[model samples]
Target: MTGTDERPDAFARTDDGVSVAYQCRGDEAGRPLVLLAGQANNHHWWDGVREDFHGTARTITLDYRGTGASDAPRDGYSTPRFADDVVGVLDALGIERADVYGTSMGGRVAQWVAARHPERVRRLVLGCTSPGGPLAVERDASVRRALAQPDPDAVRQTLTELMYSPGWIAEHPVPYGTLGDPGMPPHARRGHLVASNRHDAWNALPSVVAPTLILHGDQDRLTPPENVPLLAARIPDARAHLLPGARHAYFEEHREAAGALVREFLG
Candidate 1:
């Protein structure tokens, strides 16, 4: 199947028989960099910022079970399972290990990837994500209410506000694809929501052996900035950085600086 970018999609069948779709781009000789997207989002979540890594790494992106070209089973939607899907992709591609970067819910999955399969991750970058659970700081009540708004327009507006600053959004009046997979089924969406909500990687976080970098936006209202220290404290030797004046989509809002930081760290 061809993806939105017209690249042919590759398939990897999970142990449970679900087919996950992935796409690879950039320098073939470059090191592999696996990018995990946020809640309900497909590979396109990185559309705005993925090219920044192309010069130095082969960027790999995939759709979760319910999104994009992947098969959506009624069951198996937890972060750990999502991590397993990532491993399936790597195994199918004959990649033994690679650098990993995840954002939002994808970061939650990356936590499991590094923790459960430490041998498969060379370095880790967690962007605009929380550790998830009581130890992690959550969004404010107002933000939560806005996110839960029933109207699609309201949700998009809320997401836009949460993702980028007013100035940035005004300057770049284009879609960031934050709405996730347009064709996602209701069950898959619900599963993603439940899985992300129930994510509790506190006990497993210490097991993550990969060198980790935790990045967040100082002005973020979605995940909040306070969670960065909490994540850094749990993951041994983890470094934390905050992007000034950025929100949830800090990686996209400040791509140059964020990309430089990632490139340097991975190198």
Candidate 2:
């Protein structure tokens, strides 16, 4: 999967009846680095960031059950179900184990995956995410309002405002545009966010045997650092790093450092 000119396209269907969308690049047979996207985002979340990871490993990215190019089963998508989707994707691609990275809502699913299926995950990298359930001052009011925000464009605007800082939105037009596209799976978004708000894996953190690297933006408004301490204290041997002046999309805003941390952790 290695080559700068080679870009992420799409993976075909697995036997379980879901047409998993994925892109492969970097080392052909190296340990797979699987990327899971945030809430309402598809496989395209790692669009530019793929190059950073592709250099050292074979990168595999999949749009979870209700996001991106994958099948959006309106009825079958919660946090745990999203973890199941990863299992399905790995099984479909014939991958038994992989290094995993996720952010925000994606990070939640990755936690569940790593905890529930430790054997399948070699290492874990979490960014701008939470362990789950009522972390800090979780204002369900705004989130709920955002959920029923009239229509797609409104939803896009609402999420963009909450997810990224004004500087990030201004400088990074690509993801800003990506977030505002409004082509996301609504059912998945509503379901996932609701689940994420109330879900907590604090007790389960002790069971995750895989090496873990947690990254969060110092200025993150989405998953505030206030709640991250619980994650660090609970997860054994898990290291947490704070990115200066970064928002929720810290990985992209500070791509070099984010990539470096990931490379180091994965190594």
Candidate 3:
């Protein structure tokens, strides 16, 4: 299935009154796969790789409360809460269970989902993420400073450079825009940042019963490649894979290989 069969964008109201926006595509009869985006990113974050699962999985993507078309509430921003929002979306769509693939902040949220709601996840794929808390390896201060540039354009440029290799960026230049939802308000963006920073799933990871695959780019500086093993060690049934010469956006930069790996694991 493709464009013709894609479901229209819809809203799933969370218990807290935030209406999360989601869309479904790919094979309607195929196994369901939920693609969770990074912090602050909306459903569009999966646009580049979603098609890779077209024939084998019914792909579902959604905008978290503070991003995309979802309502941006002033509070209730945390990784665990984000996980609950995902469950709410599934409940609204009448989906009982699904395979889940999450990258960056989404990966953190996925950890909580599998831990807190094991019955809702058949399999899990965590890409470019960490276990959070003090045990997790953090990026260098320089990388943090670069990303914290006051100018949005500078921050975007820094992110683009950090996410992809120079050759890839030159070959496919991205337009000037925020890496996440461009329309995200200051409060919402801040909420996302805080939520991402506060994520600590170390204690809960051992409770994840779903088989897991951890992917990371060896060259990643934003999330650091070191966190992959930390995650693999915590999850009961998990394996880790690293992509050489890839950065934070390895899933996009190496979509073919990444997609193939995810397909095989989910199958």
Candidate 4:
């Protein structure tokens, strides 16, 4: 509803009764495409990339539980539960299959979806994400400390550095200033982080039958690009793409190029 598309703002109730908010854009009859955001972020973060798929596919973006307009449950915030929320949305919309694109923590959830519900996923795009658990390449202590900053401006500055290349940040000041701020309360944010920390997709990767595209920024500090190849090698039919000079927000920092790659792969 927030995009150029005319679809109404909608909500789908998950099996546990949490209400998940989502929006649909592009051609409904076209291939269904689901966009999942990273940790502490919501569906609105996909605004910058959704336009690229406008006429080619039906783009669906949803708020994970405890973020955006979705109802935050007191518990059950694990990656598996998050994956079920996605499938719940698909079932509510009467979609039999979809191509899923996830970033950061959302990618972990997407892995669960593809592994646990293989019949429902046609393809997967894991951007700036990791396989999770002990196999995941974690950020340095300073980066982790930056994430824990309480000041909004400090948090933004730290995130900009962690997410975008210097050139991209300088060129896109406005977008950088208005980055998607997940309005979850402190407790909810903590819960989300806990869920992220618990994600373990290593065992599930080999079972994901859907063809996968693992895209990462060459300069990503949060999830090192080295994890890309390791992740690709684990999946049966996975491809890895390293965007030169881009950071964790590679898809956003290199919007046109990254979007083109996604379009080509999804086509």
Candidate 5:
């Protein structure tokens, strides 16, 4: 089961009357770590590695406005909007500051938060993401086709293929039957896609005062690994970690290594 399945659901009301869904785990000690998932994912994306942080930090996983149990409005899906939702979650939970980790499009959201609200973020971790603009690398045709798939099952299957390395997928296969639950709606997914495509953080990276870490899979097809160096170069105090032979789901496939790297970086 995923983390969301094991943890109780909670809601944080955004200023604009939207309810952002989240799940909090781990102990009350150390800085809180907020996890933001990819374009089409929810809190469950952290299921494989979240428990590794149980004793190290308070881990909070949130769903984007248009995904999961979060309130999906007709519009308003931007990186800044998502960043505000992050602040809303923290405010509702009475958390003053947090170390934020985001993947894919969520990484773009994290960039906005770190840039716009420097004091709210203690540190930032971005994985399998890019500094969107003309400078960023493009996704392969197959990957683009997969992301644009409308059917839930088709999307999940295509996503699985794009995420993991063939070797990893073969050794530890996913149970496709239990993949997507309460899948994202077509309109919401489209909103997320548009927001991601329009995100441009190249100019804002230098303003992100938080110590940043960029993690990418060397074999990542959706978000090219080439963007890693560009992100690290732009962020004032940033470093990059590229996992060899790994794909988009490197964090889940190499949970132990990724968890250790994150813990060390946060400390």
Candidate 6:
């Protein structure tokens, strides 16, 4: 059986009147490690590393606007608005600077955090994320087809193809029944995906000054492994980790290995 959706330990109200949903784990006195989740994912991505890093850092995971426990804005989402929401979360929590850990679309925000408000970021860790929209949003036919399909079953099956590694599927195949029950609501998931697809940052990647760690699965189908070399070469102080046999969900596909790598990189 699948698990119930988890709740954050505490929530801070944002200036937009939306409640920025978040969970804090580890020592309250530790350095801040804020998790910015990717599109179609909430704080759930941190399930493996949350507790492990909590002792070393005050780990926090946030549900961006229109995703997870965060309020869905009526007008909808874009990179700028999403960036504002991140600022709002930090403001409410009284955090001045933080080590940002972002995945997929969350990584995009981390990029903006360094670009627009460089002072807010202490360091950044981006996983399976692209630099911007042009190459970022170009969808593969099959994945796009699945998103447009009316049947939820079809979409879930399609996403699984891009999300896990062949080795993972071979040994720990996901149960088809529970796979596509997305964490975010249906309408919101589509909006989040829309925001992710349309985001373009190629013109601005060079401006990022904060130290960055970029990790991608060599076998990634969605973002593709090529992006690893491409992103690392451009962003100054950026390092890339191309993990073999890993896929889109690098953390979940190789949780233990990823955990050790992250601890060292973040420390």
Q: What is the lDDT of residue 52 in candidate 6?
A: 66
Best by lDDT: 1
As a TM-score, model 2 comes out at 0.85
Query: lDDT of all the models against the reference?
Result: 0.91, 0.74, 0.90, 0.85, 0.84, 0.72
Per-prediction TM-score: 0.97, 0.85, 0.97, 0.94, 0.91, 0.87
TM-score of 3: 0.97
List candidate 3 segments past 4 Å from native: 3-6, 176-178
Q: Is candidate 3 or candidate 4 better by TM-score?
A: 3
Badly placed stretches (over 4 Å) of model 6 are 1-9, 135-139, 170-186
lDDT, candidate 1, 1-267, per-residue tens? 111245679999999999999999877778999999999999989888887887788889999999999999999999999999999999999999999999999999999999999999999999999889888898899998888888988998889888988888899997677667889999999999999999999999998899999998999998988999989989996999999998999888898999899999999
TM-score of 1: 0.97
lDDT by residue (1-267, candidate 3, tens digit) is: 683455678999988888999898887898889999998889888887788898788899898898888899999899999999999989988999999999999999999999999999999999999999999999999999998889988988899998888998889877522277888889998999999999999999999999999999999999999898899999999998999999999999898889899988887
Scanning candidate 5 in windows of ten residues, the lowest lDDT window is 173-182
Clashing pairs for model 1 are none
Model 4, span 142-247: residue lDDT tens: 8889878889889778877888777776877655422455478777787888998998989889999999998998988988887898789889999989998888
lDDT ranking, best first: 1, 3, 4, 5, 2, 6
Better of 2 and 6 by TM-score: 6
Report how far residue 143 has shifted in candidate 6, in Å.
Answer: 3.4
- Candidate ranking under TM-score, highest first, comes to 3, 1, 4, 5, 6, 2
Pairs that clash in candidate 2: 1-25, 1-26, 1-28, 2-26, 133-199
